[model samples]
Target: MRLHPVVSLALTGLVALATGARAESWNSVTVSWTAPGDDGMTGVASAFDLRYSTSPITAASFGSATRWTSTPAPAAPGTTQSVTVTGLLPSTTYYFAIETADEVPNWSSISNVVSRTTSPMPDAVRPAPLTVAVTSVTDSSASLGWTAVGDDSLNGTVSSYDIRYSTSPITATSWSGATQVTGEPLPAAPGTPQSCTVRGLSREVTYFFAARAVDDAGNLSALSNVPSVTTLDSMPPGPITNLSVGFVWLGWHSSLAIRPRSAEARGR
Candidate 1:
């Protein structure tokens, strides 16, 4: 179609401006950091596209890139925020990218790529040390009492206490088979007690006692130190004393069934 020169130029200019406006122009740049632990920190990037990879990177190449649309926005740029990623493989290295998405461009360039390795978790903490006291003791059994341990995770809140006992002494290794005597529940108020008597132990046999605190999350504290006690052992009556020979003979004469004999004869 034939058109005037001004008209053609005006159309071209409009197209160019539209294309440029759609492509680049968001130039705000910022960086922030976060520490998962004492070991490392993560940089929260802004105004830049981020791509992460376990291996060395090249332009626009990321082993894994932050899915900004799906992932939550990183905290304010140039600031560090602490976060712990749970269920991460132990001792594995992970790479991350921080980037900004400019409305003008199809995809923005990544600003900085930071990599960090997760720490290996230690064995779960043993139930906190607790004191289980014996309130009463009988010839055959004893009554025990205990208080719950404070959970540090919940700001010193306690969820429950596991009351364990064994006729044998309680040790970390030996307590595996110990009977769980009581499970004292800690309501929101907390500070509830657990008391129960243990029976079926042999007289004079020492039994050990211990308790463990379990938070609502099922984290168990270390087993407390073993406390032990022995059952009562009552002695038998004393032996008979010496008596007159005449009285003994008279008693024997009166009742043949009740007759008494000399020690040597009886022994023979």
Candidate 2:
């Protein structure tokens, strides 16, 4: 069988697969068969005809199918023969067949057909990174807003959000180490305005925040834009009143207190 290099194929980056659509992949499959001879399994064949098609491939239909390229030369008659075909479509079924020829240009009959269905592609694309901003803040909590995005870059609604905050600036690399805010709402439709509030933060503390989006396929987007805010300082040093300066009579005493401040929450 003589395999040609010319084959047809198409490529597309479909991160947001439509409902019920088959997933696509970038992969290949191999086909193998025992070698046939130049003259009835007696001698090495001079050339090979290797072809594949989406439909059943037969002796008559082989010429119209896509031929595999650079097939290895036949071995001694009755030896093993194999070929790895590439550029095949993902999540597709294909049929392959072959014929053998001799130095006399005499061609043998096509071999029995073989069929294989490729695996569906994996979802490796991450959601669009969010660009979050502060919307409101109180002594113990804060609200955040950002343009909503989907599972893929502006492709479809994501499955969830991982909102995190820290006194230090947050980043994609540091996302896992930051404090995660719970009760995040399900992601909104792509391009919709979205908002969420983080609770249990300390008053009068500065906090830095960032977020990541997750897909049903478990794909995670990079961290969103980091934003910072200080919670309302409504608790501390509430107006000391009644200034009474008595003469240095009996023992006079005074006291004070302190605590580490936590920043308000921020996220996508």
Model 2 score (lDDT): 0.76
Question: TM-scores across all candidates?
Answer: 0.41, 0.63
* Lowest summed lDDT window (length 10), candidate 2: 4-13
**lDDT score of residue 4 within candidate 2:** 21
Which predicted model would earn the best lDDT?
2
Residues 25-112 of candidate 1: C-alpha lDDT, one tens digit per residue: 1221122333121111223222333343446444446535433233334343334432222333445565655434322322333434
Q: CA lDDT, every prediction?
A: 0.50, 0.76
Clashes of each: 13, 8
* Candidate 2 lDDT, 41-159, residue by residue in tens: 66677887788899997667889999787788878766666666767677888787777778878776677777777766667788999899999999999999988887877898999
Model 2, residue 110: what's the lDDT?
72
User: Model 1, 2: alpha-carbon shift in Å?
Assistant: 31
Worst 10 residues of 1 by lDDT: 6-15
What does candidate 2 score on TM?
A: 0.63
